[model samples]
Target: MGWCSCINLFPPSCQLSELKSTMYERQKKLFDSCQRASKVVAYRLKTPPYKLDALEPYMSQRTLELHWGGHHRQYLEYLNRALGKNDILYGCTIDELVKVTYNNGSPLPEFNNAAQ
Candidate 1:
């Protein structure tokens, strides 16, 4: 159960059990949706944030320096760290995490550190 359902449960006393049932259904729906989404974006190939040679002379052989040596390597590292737990996010997709944490918030604890 999630915080919402717990609140809707005993809080301010009880109602028809219908409220409880409804909250249960909602939480179930959310979990199902998360699961479905995770499956959808799983096992994708890693792509660098920038194009080869985009950085040019200053960063020459730059594609290899950053894309392969840095960005690609980091993706593999992050993948290992992120999958370490059968934690809440164990089944989550890389794309899903990227989409979810695109904004500032409490860091994902594992993924945020791995990505950096």
Candidate 2:
């Protein structure tokens, strides 16, 4: 006899149907959770308070632009890409992400991007 046929409390058919129903409910819940987490948030890069050449005497316009627009912008892009909508870290604040990714002394792969 099959495993389901050995059950004495409920009919074999009823037990099998109940098991299938329970499995279906679990699958549905998982599917819904994934759908909710699929909405990725896009972070925008904030511009400097002053013009690119604001600190002309101390810092050159080209240098500031390269650092701010190039390097900083690139870091933000990497961070956003690393934290996708489906990622558990996606909705966390920068501070939270940094701490979580820090993993005590050993850092995770996304630690650098999150720290930046």
Candidate 3:
């Protein structure tokens, strides 16, 4: 028999199209589960308890502003972007988000953002 004819020799379950469909269904289920688990929530940056200049001589105002305002805020922005409104991790606490995105050491794309 020709190469094309050999495809029919295999059972329907073993066919390439069937395999792809099965994989697609599994992915769709996962996506749906994530969607169902998510809740809408807003994340905000917390202000430091003390004034930025409180630690003067020990830590400069400019340094604190750069680190807290610039870097920390940027990290939060990136995290919010990564965990878009409908994301599975959306509305999760920072600690929980970090742990989940860590993915048992495999680490998802949002792990860094969550950890930061």
Candidate 4:
């Protein structure tokens, strides 16, 4: 079998561990970007969502300030807190996590928390 085939053979916890490591690396980059930014915060938007202009005339600059700044930023900050430790995800790549978790059909719980 090919090297990758072994991935499919791994048990759930092993797979989850692999996914965790991969996701951690990938998330590290995003985390680094956040650290570089003045606010040190990154964003994650839920759907049924659009850019400020998508709402157009109804969503004026003031609306964006309230929605993106107040609402969106709040979500990101809260998500960061839910992720708990900084070093956990900062060391792996998202692709690696995805590959290992592939056998599990879904990501590990930490993946959901961190990606969000």
Q: What tens digits encode model 1's per-residue C-alpha lDDT throughout 55-98?
A: 67767665567667787676766665665652334555565555
Candidate 4 lDDT over residue span 3-54, tens digit each: 5433466666777778878766765555554422133233355454666567
Which 10-residue window in model 4 sums to the lowest lDDT? Answer: 34-43
Best first by lDDT, ranked: 3, 2, 1, 4
Alpha-carbon lDDT, every model: 0.53, 0.69, 0.71, 0.52
Model 3 ranges off by over 4 Å:
1-40
Q: RMSD in Å for candidate 2, one decimal?
A: 12.8
Residue 100, candidate 2: Cα error in Å is 1.1
Worst 10 contiguous positions by lDDT, candidate 3? 27-36
lDDT of 3: 0.71
lDDT at 31, model 4: 52
Misplaced by over 4 Å in model 4 are 1-58, 91-116
Index of the highest-lDDT prediction: 3
Clashing residue pairs, backbone N/CA/C < 3 A, model 1: none
The Cα RMSD in angstroms, rounded to one decimal, for candidate 3 relative to the true structure is 7.6
TM-score of each candidate?
Answer: 0.42, 0.60, 0.64, 0.33
Q: How high is the lDDT of residue 52 in model 3?
A: 94
